[model samples]
Target: MGLLSGRRRPHAARRSIRALLAATLTAGLLAATGPAVWASERPAAARTEAAVAAPGDDWLRTEGNKIVDANGDEVWLTGANWFGFNATERVFHGLWSGNITDITKSMASRGINIVRVPISTQLLLEWKNGQAAVPSGVNAYANPEIAGKTSLEVFDHWLALCEQYGIKVMLDVHSAEADNSGHIHPVWWKGTITSEDFYTAWEWVTARYKSDDTLVAMDVKNEPHGTASTSPRAKWDGSTDQENFKHVCETAGKRMLAINPNLLVLCEGIEIYPKSGVSWTSTTPTDYHSTWWGGNLRGVRDHPVDLGTHNDQLVYSPHDYGPLVHQQPWFTGDWNRTTLERDVWDPNWLYLHKENKAPLLIGEWGGFLDGGPNEKWMTALRDLIVEHRIHQTFWCLNPNSGDTGGLLLGDWKSWDEEKYALLKPALWQHEGKFVSLDHQVPLGGVGSSTGISLSEVYDGPTDPEDTQAPTAPTALASTAKTSNSVSLSWTASTDNVRVAAYDVYRGTTKVNAALVTGTTYTDTGLSPSTAYSYTVRARDASGNVSAPSAALKVTTESSGTPSGAVKVRYKNNDASATDNAIRPSLQVVNTGSSAVKLDGVALRYYFTRDGSASVSAWCDYAAVDCAQVKLRVVPLTTAVSGADAYLEVTFAGGSLAAGGSTGDLQLRMSKADWSNFNEANDYSRTTSTAYTDAPAIPAYTGTALAWGTPPT
Candidate 1:
């Protein structure tokens, strides 16, 4: 599912007799009842600043269902989610809009005492292996000081800024992939990642921040739920060891506690079975269900996870969503706070808190704030939090959530004042003590240091004389080759100070973002049956890059299946035009054995633009048939001042048979707008998958043609 589709909810049960009966009974209740009034008004705040402990003193631990300081005073977590480390981008989202320090300061001003950051295990492994890059464009432009730093180093920078701003952090292992889809694996381990690796990730993270008091806890795995009937290993069984939530939590939690006992172990519930009077058997009917990821805690009542020595530190965290995500049965038919609490809240996981079994943290909860059913749901949820004094974090502080938009909107610079106004009254620390209307007090104060500085933690060089580049690696050779990946090894390079890392490039495109420190590197995610050329460059601690090593080329094995493919060739059509412009032509061909149909094809062209230049428009000069193609052009920024643009031409419902071509489609650009076109620079092409026979495009080459004059 696309990220903009909103958070995916639990799969609805198939229509059956039981479902029909439940719907009929619900409708009957609505017909028999008159209009009812729910306590939708905001509940009065129960505790104030005097009731809570001072911010940022000692490490925190759970004391009888409550988080308390070393002095034993209560500490409430009122924060918002800033997701991204778990996303495909692998960095915080709004860094492009503002600095990390400034963003944290802004959150502090809003009475947010904590920040819940979601991350993925794969990203952690990449960072640990020194293969994570701090993506280019916006991220690089905004954080220029740490432009080439590894992802882990960038994460540390953000943590340092959080510590500087007096904000606590709860790390959430959101997914296995950097993308949004991995959260529903039923267990923390998925695909190439193993259960042992999952545990090891926690161990690494705990050890890294073991002494950092600002990082309070680890929110285990985000929303462990799938088919919960024991088939795919998602059942809540305490006795079983394989794929059991209790077993995994106890194992990982004990290890983490051993490393940092002060850290809280936040365990969430699974969405499975056990309705009302039903027994705890695998087949028991589960009437009530959790709406969001890692939300269904109904099983906690029967089998509360045993965290061993860290049991007291266990916090039962669950996520709740509004009608926008999914309208549970209780949400319909004379629904009010009473029905919602009885049908959905109590049976799911609220009973644990109501029975004083554990401290409850609403790990995530927020919606569009569109002032209707969503508004009412927010009000009721807020009432419960205020009345129960529960620890809470809003779904996000980002503007990227397609479901629950953010507390900040528009250019990401301005606050969603409406949300701030709604949430401020419920904050544990209001506008005076820990937070203020004017300025923020750094967590331990302005000069207080945690002994962990950027230089102390990061591997990048801190001195000036290390500017010399490392010697270029020698004898680069392909050790192994596969259809989708190539493994290469080369003689290590030496530098004046030390060779920090090596970069592997496929043609002119850098394939790996994280520096390769080892003599060997494996490049994955390649096209089958394609020839690829590689070069390696070494860099020193001071960011000096060496010249590329000798090139090594290899061809990957084929799939053996007859498939269609698209190949694009570029040529300088004209350069002597009177408008001081250059005309480029693209020849697309069906290079594969099968017929290929295309809805569209796009090319990302890179060049150096003149100072203070801008693209007025892209003009179509010629094509095989101009009437059969619709052309669109968009300008993009590849670097701080570089000109990057993509030209997309959509075909008018056509297909190119085997060895056929799109003839020549020509485009014109003003030389006054762009100069120094880097034809040698790697360009990108994307083929349309709209047709069943649209095979993946094989890799093509871009040539650097001489630029003197147009050919006669």
Candidate 2:
């Protein structure tokens, strides 16, 4: 893509080719752009683009990774991209000759029930500033209906056509500017167009269409891309920087949703992601795995987009293309679906669907080379999409797309019969009729008999109703207490349906502003020495709440001395939550006035056994000797959040002299089954590689707690 087709920017040199090809349409009109076979595979009747008096309440939300309607019925969005609004044309291409009415209806009748319209932020801003669009891009003699209308008006007209034909609309901010080759630029902002401008443009448009159910989604940005060595390159990260695509998408998506809560927010991935052991600092080519622009989603494994309360409205849209666009490395060898899924799709984007992280839409995928490797890749992806019910939008409707030719032939009136044949199986169909995302409206509306609405296909919800509640959380107990706060935890609850949330209660009043999704919770803002009681209840997706668990009462520690003289410093040998073994090196310093006997001291390293109860340990080395150290894993009698078990360390031989130190006692712990541990929430676990004070790892002198805070 010298990364071509990704930004679709001379280096989108590909756009020059597309621009030149599109320019020729001004002369030949008919001779240069004709379908291979001018056969009508379409339904007998054509639908008109008349405005609909009643638009369906067809807004959708996600369940697990499936897109479900208001009635909880699953619906697939089989769509195609109609470019030009994002380009210099400032409106849909092929409008010069093809009637927008005919094309929009043709899509609904032929199974393309949704359209992803690419538009630039600059054009939206121009419309926002009341700038009139020039009519040069529109051939008034050929299609006079929208002749004198502004670009915004033309888009509104298209939205009306979609509503009448039962085709949903999704707007994509393809670039910061209105230039034909704007995608070539990497980030969302450029020169005069700030990121705020990009966001405000969306707010204005969303406010305009808030009542219209026709436009259901907004692709936060087109293809945020650039290499590690390139400037203005987009990176997928947790940072709030301008170059961080994740933050930008979240910021923009949240802003749009604030205006229209029903809109599906599509966040696309960036072009490149750092490989294992590599950071953005590494400029070497091998340090990263590059994908088609907006296609690499590996960063999601670690830094997922946090929509907070609006997570159900989030969808991940990744764009993929065939080798004909750019022969990426995966295409180098003989590759099939299995290989591609393993090497490319799974790591890049497919995992989101598989892991139920989010809904995924292949925002761009289609090309002209239907004979060889390109078609092979396309065919494989099509199968995956059909089998998994993943949402998608094929690349172009205009043949002007340089790398991936249009789904329609150059003439723009006829569909590429061969390509449509391959894609037909992936479309949402019931019996012989294609399905519409709308509930009441039939696809192609009243004129065509080829399609059915979401209700017509399902008739009722396909999934069984979830009425059962999750089990109450078990073994709720206080983990730690401070002068001002108290931390609590419990065993995870089981649910017949997904456990949507955990509600924590102080006495009888709910203390959390939002439902807690995890087992651990820390309640702060309390009076020192005051008594408190806490309980937790689990809730399922259907709004059923389980009975509250047994309550635990405790009094906060009064303001006093800073605990004991025996202090502990620990270094995490491995910080991965899924690591096979936890290796934490412990060092104990004796700050007491007299010598402390090793046999009388005990250090508890709190962690989670993670389901495997049978545990073992190894004393890699000790200050005295490896044989002198004894390690025992003990599950907590009353489970507290983050820490379900503790590794008790006792010395068999060795005594700490006054003002003496135990150099380094390297220890390792693991379950007998060798299953992984989730150390992320462990109270004593630290991500720091260097040794630091571990107040969470409580120490004791005989029966008295000596150091740090222990679970009450």
Candidate 3:
């Protein structure tokens, strides 16, 4: 049953009956098809954005090929599967190793909009019959948050957490019993658990949460598959409700919908299908088409699950895996996306989506990082999902998915960054930020750096379109600096409905291609020691933008070696308030044992050029003769917060030995008109008459630099 070997996968059903049983018994079968801000209330005036859990009417239904919210805005259910309630554990699998609350919050922050929780019919019936147990599977030390609760209570607590984080859930019937390897069975009903028990399980949970919309979906059953000549197998035909998957789906779907009409019912495909004119009575393997379990949907063309009054609630879900799970015939030789879609997927289940018969969700699709055919197959499926905007809950978030290693690594806390990067584009995102299913809270709760809410997506309710623009952001500041990036933060802007996102600007050009949904943004891909000015503007879903905020100036750190040979010092030569000329002196002192002798070493002083008068500079005095000193006045291409120009000073032929100083290299500057200049807010201005360390005056050495010159 381990995912490492294909022999134990679903394809074993294609072998001799004895081999098939061996594979089933040893196989841990699944997927070959499968599929914070706590309780704060909304403020009186929603105009001002607050990081709180607001309870908005969260109900969803389906249009032709899209799952829409109450306002009929298309929303994507991009998420992952967390299996455990269906297994012998009864609780989540990782609760033994990770904190349940932390795990839930982490998922929401990582753009998981919905969670497909695999559960067993036996477990639900147990809860109904008051057989709830404090699952011994959990390690209490790791999950102190729900240490004393029963498995049922833990699930309830998780639902509350989902509401707080703006995530949704879909209950999937993974198997008939609570056995660890129960998914290997071919039929929904096994042993004492009858098919009626399955229907009753869905009914009980549906009624329990009829008023709560967080549990918005119900997957009728896990993969149902069986080959010909296999008795007590799940069969699909355009006939009565014996073992026909279509009839069972219709029956269970109707029963669940009766309790709460807003729920989405997902129906999966079975194993083998009658080919062309072949009948179900045929026992010949060649007479039928065999695909991955729960992946053969050819029967949908003939016998579709009909929900008379609740047709909109039906969504056809199919599970597809890579070669590692079980390499079907089409996986060999030069296979590509075009071939796979046309040969395997088109006839199986993708047709339902292509023809707009119903909305499709690829309930399970993932595999190990084989870097071979498996990755190739996963890439093709991921591309299809992204191109068509198909809804999906990835195979798993757990790292223990045997054949298909999960999105999370073995540690459970650390994520498989590569796999997540591959899946990110398929998640529902707007303006570069992940989108949530809840209309009130954004994904990942309030103040999340990663997502926005459904109301932010479609401008709130349909009664009136959002027309009010968000308020201008305030208190913009650069919080952190790196050689190639700057992190910024500001107060949140308020909108009538919700602020969709924000736009960051450098000079006049928009630096961020997509709008930022959070209050913080780290602008990257910048040059070292570069001075940049930034501003921010708030935007609403209606495309209304607020006025720009006050600009903030930041200079990146130098990407160079440490300055050990010399240190630059400065002193204001004159502090006269009414002076027509400004004077300053800078001297490079050699601190290290080696002499500071290089043509590249220089010092720079920054100041604003007042009026249009041309400026002049000269070396007034130097320990070395003025002939060896050099000075230049340069105008800036972009004016920052307080300065627009800088004065550069350098020495040509002097070697300041260790513990020596280029003493008192004085300089002076003034406009041609002799206009008095104010240096109150100049970036390099200093009032201290005595010489001290001056980091403000950038100094440059041969291999090391400190803000003086632009990067080459």
Candidate 4:
């Protein structure tokens, strides 16, 4: 929600300065004991001690634009955000799905060194007031001992577990209230919560964890964005205390550092009107609009916050969203990946890192791992991060984000392996180091004798004797055939090493990105009476591929009559926002005597509001609890200019029997789908089996319905 909307203001008034004269004096005293004195008069033991100052401390500090450890070695923040403590639940999501310990272990195993935990002021205050309670069924998978503990106690235990796992924590003050809607309200303090209360809450939270090194940083405010003209409570000026973000940060940051100077203070940018005429670079405009909350940083170039003595502790943080969230002007208009980075990314936040002004941390950025433009955007962003060595934490580790799902899928147990594959390359631990499929060799380049040699590294597996590929899958046959789906089973293949996975293919198209470990695959969304051919191939872990197995053909039963109907269903996830997308889930039913052939289905969506249409479809057969039907989603096409658009979903070999139905063909219509979409007025949908040749269906001809109403 912090990334969706808002603008933050700059500081106007300076607070009472508290100087740490003790530390300054200590540093001055150390400087007075010069190297000459140690070299000229020190004893042998003293000389040895002088030659090697105690190994750099483990505490982290900022020097220039880098985050350095006690040893003065640069440390990159490779982490993931686990949200939900800030939500209405006020507890981490998926505690019912898996144990928090296991989740933390999983993150650590993947080389994630830190985890950003978002929390709310209300929840913290609730804990402070001893009113925080862990409801029943909330900690089903958590430690048995923590079942009856308070929210704060559970959080303390989580921190202990994180420390045991060597993972650091950054507490994010996401909202004043523990609800998703609370994030959109520009200022951190709202409703009953006053500005003083907001500061007091931070002071209390920071004071409680000041002694713990596991809790490393504090993100001052999530995303502050609103205008004086629109929402007077959310304006930014260098002179006002009520709505000025800079002023708030200075006061809050000073208090936080006073409790723990080792803590890094993360400051985010405002979304809109970031200092009317300020620009980070000449190419960026003074009045440029930041697409998401806390994304705009142009104002920083002119009016950087003065965090007093704790200035070096500052890290410029920003949030970025891809086309999936909202298709901004930069996403369209003949802009390719290079142009996007050059025109949009560079000026926004990348310039900060490039110019070495401050260490830039991408606080939030992620999208569905589905292969499409979003994937391309992710790739481009990852490449830029790698190229610049920018520190970042993937947007989330939970599976419940409505806008962008997390790195895990279904029940929050399995990893989205595709996403992991895409992100693993950009991991800082592997940066500038040669990593083999088996293990990584630190400093493992040209002449580092301590590391694995290049010849030994690239010479394939150490087991040279096992060169045989797994035998091709055999006895493949359809276990069951439906009008629109076919379930297949086959004899497992044998390998000298081990059969890793089996590949299922319809004609030449591969259906799954991740490997199919079992000897079965269900191909759905088939055309009735269509003879579809499928083949299976086996592969081993050593990259050995087997020949395709004997192909099997199956034809779906025919529909006795040509009488079927299509209807649409929708759900308004966030009805509070005027610019929210309408997620439509379609259902195709067969009213025919027999099975009906359904090679493809076409859907036309009409909008009552005056806005352009944008669509995104979801269909993955391998996904757990996923849509049972498989579809090759075509890109959106606007038929009636911007008023309406149609998207075609083609099946590999799908059909529908009499009284059978295709469960849910899910699709998302962007907020831009209608410039003025009337929530009160119901949208209409028309569908047809004839995909390529189907004519544009008129709206209100069939059944028209609003969200929550049953589709007839």
Candidate 5:
């Protein structure tokens, strides 16, 4: 049955003699007189129950109240947005069947419960002039390059699949050609059907889904264009456009009620005055572009004749975006606590709810453009939705390769783990329908926007203290020996909350630090036969640290060389002892068998003045810091054949090797910064080792091989 309208029945038959006698008896019974009763004492009850149950798919009209299951329990709709359900020619088309099912089921497991199906009227009726065939494929979008399948056929199949997954579907007519909403409109809506055109289309789809409980409400028009003053006067005819909407809506609502009055009727919001025009910047009106909320839609405050019914069985749908408020001039220019609450958000709510007397269902609001998903905005939006009991369907679910708008990609064959991780918790759920304290704030408060706030929602796992497992108390380390340095590695600890990073503690203090992107970590720089206890701790994104992992006792193998001496000498036949003063030459020799890693290297040299050692220059060589800089792979198993040491030299005002001279020289490393190449646990260089001799500068006798900045 269509939403708002209840089922109708055939004419009732009346009895003759028996009916007459019953009427006579009823009259006598009233004459017998009744006990005095207070009119105010009349028991109260809801007219809601006796009314034919509303269709389960009418999510918008119900406000926060959800359709109940057979058990009479509220059922929240948690599903993906199928914005790609248009013609096959569309690039972001979503493929259906097993793959979509698999992806959706995964979503279901993650707590998703409903699907918002976006379809273009043009695809359904325009292609075949209103008659079409359905396409077939394991992937809907993957239907072979055949043309026979019509949009109607495609939708029928789509609905069937939704049934298989036991998910409710909301068929949204994204656009209308006559008014030019957003999606391509069918030719029928392009000034073809007259005043009854919209109703006719509604009847066609509604009648088709009459018996399908899974079919939800229908949206009249996506985002109606033009306002009263700005719109053409003829377009505002009493029998068409706004007027026609009321006429068609009531008539269709009645017809739908005859079938099933349970269906919900959804209406999209208009762009009010002064709203951040970010979402509509490209298509904003030229002269009468809206700047006030209630002033735009005259009929809303005045209840124009076109708004079928009293706005009781209706839902108000609006769209919001972050860049509109955060980056645009409308909102950001005069941004203040008062402006955010009253000028920005409150007016929209007042019109949709107070004036219209309908619950709002945010049809589309998401991260888009280069703005991406702003967690701050998302949180605020969520809180506002929850506050008003407004339902919402994120603008898209597929990877929006064009303008930003998807939580996932359309490929459907694979999954994006990181994206999923970032979005999973932020996903709106059927449970906890109300805005929690963490996500709300009073108007004019110290928050992003007054009346709602989305900041600091993720404060780490608060409930279930065992969320993140603590690091082990004991330390376990595995060591490897090399001619220059000893390398050690260890395992990471378990945790309930996600581990942000790991710290490697030598003896009692942390010597190496690495981010916990994966499992293993390696430590360089060690003395033979030296025993050390390395502890690891798991930290959260908020900087909350967990107990240290078990200490792993490791002992390095002794080498023949002295504990911490490193010498540099010149190599190559063209080099000489005096080259140290001219071009400079040196080599690092580790006499010790235990492998050693110099976290950083620095050098002090003299350019012998009158046979006296004098300081000429100094240098520090180190790695550059990057967001994920801690991620690196330093080979600890280098062969003694010159591969054991990492070497490089830098000069000021360009390099002498480049025919330029006079510069400081030094060697530098992360000072035991753990690169997350291996598991977070690894050995670290403890003792400071230095090489006094400087390396010989390469001769620039020949053409330079495209010299550039050195890798920090």
Candidate 6:
């Protein structure tokens, strides 16, 4: 239930801190010096180290803001963005927890990354003991005590799954108001809260997850300026709300790092274009009230803001939902060929991408694609996403929508084939029963490589009359645990020449050969503690084996955890606070002082409440009755640093008014690998040491509130 359930990585300085601790441990066990410590005796660092050292890890480094895989391949993000994490005030890991993870894994198989997660400010507000503060219209059931335990639990689950499945995430702070952006538009914190609250929110986010690579960056605030990107008032003059949008973002970026040094902050642009913008005009566009930025800076003339003042992690993200708002007649009546370019494509691209040096992250873009140029237009937009290697998180993952912005069809259990076909080519598929060397397809560009497309299909033999014994399958599963012997089987094949023998392929490495009389064979002398998957094919004198059999999976037991490490750095890719985009990465290295075999890699993260009960979960204070309203109480305890790999939040169910708390963070190492007595020594760290601002035993009092129904 803890909010800190996701996974991520860190910078060199923070990595050094981990290494120093490890080094200290090594020094304490002088047994290393006594034996001259052969490589096998050394303790293993995590995935980050092995990635950085193996020459293979170089693929993780950035090339002009884009991430490259270990194979030196540039990865184009093709995925959907989901909101309601912090935005809806859903206790992340409570009822709504794991919903996003389920959605992400489904989308990733279809090739979608670049998720834009919209956050709500209510997650940050807090009340003192016996103080009443609650947003109206919130049901006690919706404001469950589980949420108060660790506001971060949801974020934790979201990021961990993104990392596990190989997808990137963008943390977007959607609205300053309890209600989504509009009306009191451009507000930073909900309910006219202090600017300091805004800064505090950023500080909490950046400091805690700075090391996690999957958590790419932060969108400081969503749609700060009103729809108009043109007027001076559209840009903050540091007058209207104590501080303007620009000041809030830049100042927050500075303050955040003071708490967490590696922070990437992205400031978004207003919906309206500046007067200098191509789309700018005294009147709003016929289609909508607000105008798109279209490359024009609304306040450039007055304040002369330059986003480069922040760190390299800065990025500019924009939201363009043409069909969502714009009236069709403005662009075309006939709705045929040429008009699509004139209105939607040409103008927006020029202003947003061409004029702005900052990289673009299309924060939100989706619309009905039943007919007209909608499909074609989306194709053009996707092409731009690929061409620029721009990170994109579609507007949503809602299955309730009629295929407009919905990427997955039914609660992530099924795919909207029509929509998925448009994006499937851009993703990596992890589920299938075949050994495929070709998971990638050529995206076509400078120094391009062909993507391999391998599949296991049941295609009947070309000729059945020609009698010839078939070839056996190549890949087979092992029957024994400790033995290297594996049982290989094949589906019979028909060929002109007599079937000779079957060759077993272990990864790209071939391990054994056997004569194919029947359909199965067992091969021995293979090494132990190895994971091997195989596919078999029958060979004729012509050396052509019937297509390899369906791939089967098997792995040998290992003596211990593989030795390696993975390092990650998070950065924003744009300049606008509204466009804030985060990108995380991994660098693996081997530091055992000797060669070691690496099996596989895994990463995880934990999100904890900010040392206080969640503001979103406040119950009644002075005028309140906790039991009547079903509000739970969270008392202050010890300051938490690092817990286990898995952070748990167990809340006493029911509505908790203002000052309530629940939950704890914990690391998730193998229970058998360590002991219960040693759990505190190995995992527990004072949370304040890493982030001094985070309180220990996050405790707070509830604000006054009217009693409500008990939670179901």
lDDT: the better of candidates 3 and 4: 3
RMSD of each: 30.3, 19.0, 26.1, 20.6, 24.8, 31.2
lDDT per residue for candidate 1 within 1-712, as digits (tens), equals 1111111111131113213322422222212111011100111121111122222333677665566555343456778899878888788787776566657767875667778999998887786676867564236665564567656766766665565455678999888767766665667777898878888888988887776666888998888776435455455666665557766777888999999988888988776644445444444233323344576787777778887767878998888888887765445423346445654677677776655578889989887877888877887887777655688889888888887888888566788988777776566542133431101233332432321111111111134454445588899998755555677999887553477667788898655422355788777557789999999887654444677899999887575522224555666554332334545566667766666555433333434333345443353754557666655444331221232443434455577787987776666655455544433332331222222221221221111011111101
Query: lDDT of each structure?
Result: 0.60, 0.75, 0.75, 0.58, 0.38, 0.39
All candidates: TM-score? 0.53, 0.58, 0.59, 0.54, 0.43, 0.45
Superposed by TM-score, candidate 4 places the C-alpha of residue 411 at a distance from the truth, in angstroms, of 1.6
lDDT: worst 10-residue window of model 1: 32-41
Model 6 alpha-carbon drift over 4 Å, by segment:
1-75, 89-101, 126-151, 180-184, 225-233, 236-244, 257-263, 274-290, 293-311, 328-330, 334-352, 401-405, 410-412, 425-712
Candidate 2, residue 6: the lDDT equals 19
Candidate 5 deviation (Cα RMSD): 24.8
Q: Kindly give the number of clashing pairs for every candidate.
A: 3, 6, 3, 22, 78, 125
Which candidate should be chosen as best, given TM-score against the real structure?
Answer: 3
Cα lDDT tens digits, model 2, 1-712, are 0122211122133234323432432222112111111101111111111111122467888876777666444578898999998888898899888888888889999988999999989888888788947646787876676777777777766776676677899999998888889998999899999988988999998887776677899999988898879887899877898899999878988898898898999999998888667788777655677878899888999899988788989999999988899876566433457546755787799878865668899999988765999999999999889766799998877888998888788787998888889888888776588888875556876545898665444332222354454588899987666565677999888653467667788898655432366788877566778899898877554344677899999888776623334788899887677887999999988876667788767788988888855778899988778888877776553356676667888777677887888889999988888888878888888888998888888886543456888753
Better of 1 and 4 by TM-score: 4
**597-708 per-residue lDDT for model 4 (tens digits):** 5543333444433344543445432211243333222222221223332333334346666777666555554433434344344434322222221112221101111012
Off by over 4 Å in 5: 1-80, 87-92, 96-98, 126-130, 134-151, 177-188, 191-195, 227-259, 272-299, 304-312, 324-328, 333-339, 350-356, 369-375, 414-712
Off by over 4 Å in 2: 1-55, 460-712
Per-residue C-alpha lDDT of model 3 across residues 284-309, encoded as one tens digit per residue: 77567778888888898888889889
Worst 10 residues of 5 by lDDT: 34-43
Cα displacement (angstroms), candidate 5, residue 360, comes to: 1.2
Model 4 whole-model lDDT (C-alpha atoms): 0.58
In candidate 1, which residue ranges exceed 4 Å CA deviation? 1-57, 228-233, 275-292, 430-712
